[model samples]
Target: MFKNIYFVCFILILSSCGKDPLPKPSGELRLEYPAHKYQSFNSDCAYSFDYSTFAEMQNAKQSCWFYINYPKMKAKIFLTYFPIHNDFALHVKEAEKLVYEHTIKASSIDTKSFSYPEKKVYGNFYELQGPTASNVQFYVTDSTKHFVTANLYFNSRPKPDSLAPAVEYIKKDMLHLIDTFKWK
Candidate 1:
């Protein structure tokens, strides 16, 4: 009886080890964002631009500051408008400083400048990579009278991989905003 029991146990163990366990097929979460369609954002403030129809704009304390909320993605792009007021250098410096502040955790920061001399719109667009708090920052100015800065933030934990799709979608929206931007 003991020999029969041992033989049965051995067979069971051998059967369980038959094939090599395959590693879980390495995979990543696939996320899809909405296709962007934009509309004009006209305000009583110093500047105006085109924003994604997907986002909802909310008023802030000051007339010149507003939030472009992406409720679905749990993110918002904060826009602040400042009058140049013979202090253009100070405004530009502050914008650069704000971008550099994320350097501690940023893997890389890429800046691209856009100029529309015909429309008198000029500024710098910054894309900050890594686990930084703000993934994108930009400042557009008419150089003498208007300086508008925008930055993006997510409501949840800053996971670069998880937020990549949302960031890319918003980035395109922002670029379109810059291209159509004009002083009001």
Candidate 2:
């Protein structure tokens, strides 16, 4: 009789010791961002803007624009869209020059470091990388009245391998934006 009573008490205690279930994430956690967002550039400018809310945006000091922050992941996404007046080939050459300049500037203390050119995305443009920044730059024009570029930047010190997943996520979002992009 005593053994039976003890066994029941032990079982009861063990069952009571089990932890309570964790609460589920709230509505905010459940919310999902659209694949992308599109914004026409200011009426005076010949550009357009598209990005994912997965990152936050802020303005930069120079004509080059703002900073995009990914706090939880400790990363940044940068955009610098510049207007060009030169011919397409010249604009592309200038973009390459800018990449070289950035690489030299970033690697001033370490001449051994090098930057590389990345293949164009969407098959019609080009991109370049520096020792300190990875850039995705491409030009767009409708044959007259507008010539602009969309440049995406990220710190190069961090091996892209480490940030690949997040970068890919953002890239997919950006790709969606590009696919649907239309000048206003």
Candidate 3:
């Protein structure tokens, strides 16, 4: 009787010592991103933009913009180009029109303007605004030659706050491409 009681006690004790599994560290999770790939179309058009290999590029059937996909990240980047006459004010207005039409509006808009003295990636000069109230937009022109603009959107599942970092990283890449941008 004592032996059976001891066995039951031992079993109970062992069962009572149960432990929960350790929680995973969020930082240890790995994510896969696509390799960088680029394609160049003829420069006979007003402008050209190069996209990362990870992005799938397609023209919007309804608009004049190229839709770039970052499928792994469930995000998108936008590119649009237009020819400008001699009017700087008119070009700025056109840029505003593009932004208003496409970008999502947050509670507040933050706008910063930049002027590059020399060509960086795309042409002789460029202007852009970052962390805007709506979407992202940048315009490039070589005082006398061409005008081009790019807008970025995070479409798949947009979490503006979560996407800000990735968006900024891609923006730098875009800037590099723009800085070295040349029209052939």
After superposing all C-alphas onto the true structure, candidate 3 shows an RMSD in angstroms of 6.4
Candidate 2 achieves a global lDDT of 0.49
| Cα lDDT computed for each candidate against the true fold | 0.92, 0.49, 0.57
Ranking by TM-score: 1, 3, 2
| Model 2 agreement with the true structure over 1-184: per-residue lDDT tens digits | 9999999999999989877899986532222334545443343334445656666766667564556565555555554544535565665566456555655434332112111123112212333333345534444444333444445555445444454555556656555545544455
Residues 1-184, candidate 3: write the lDDT tens digits.
Answer: 9999999999999998868879976552334344445665434465555656666777766344567666766666656665556775677677667655533444444454555555433222222233343345666766555666666665535445555656666666566556556654
lDDT, residue 126, candidate 2 = 38
RMSD of each: 3.8, 10.6, 6.4
> Candidate 3's C-alpha lDDT?
0.57
Q: What's model 2's TM-score?
A: 0.49
lDDT of 2 at 37: 52
Ranking by lDDT: 1, 3, 2
The weakest ten consecutive residues by lDDT in model 1 span 25-34
Summarize candidate 1's per-residue lDDT along 124-168 as a digit string, tens digits. Answer: 999999999999999999898988899999998888988998999
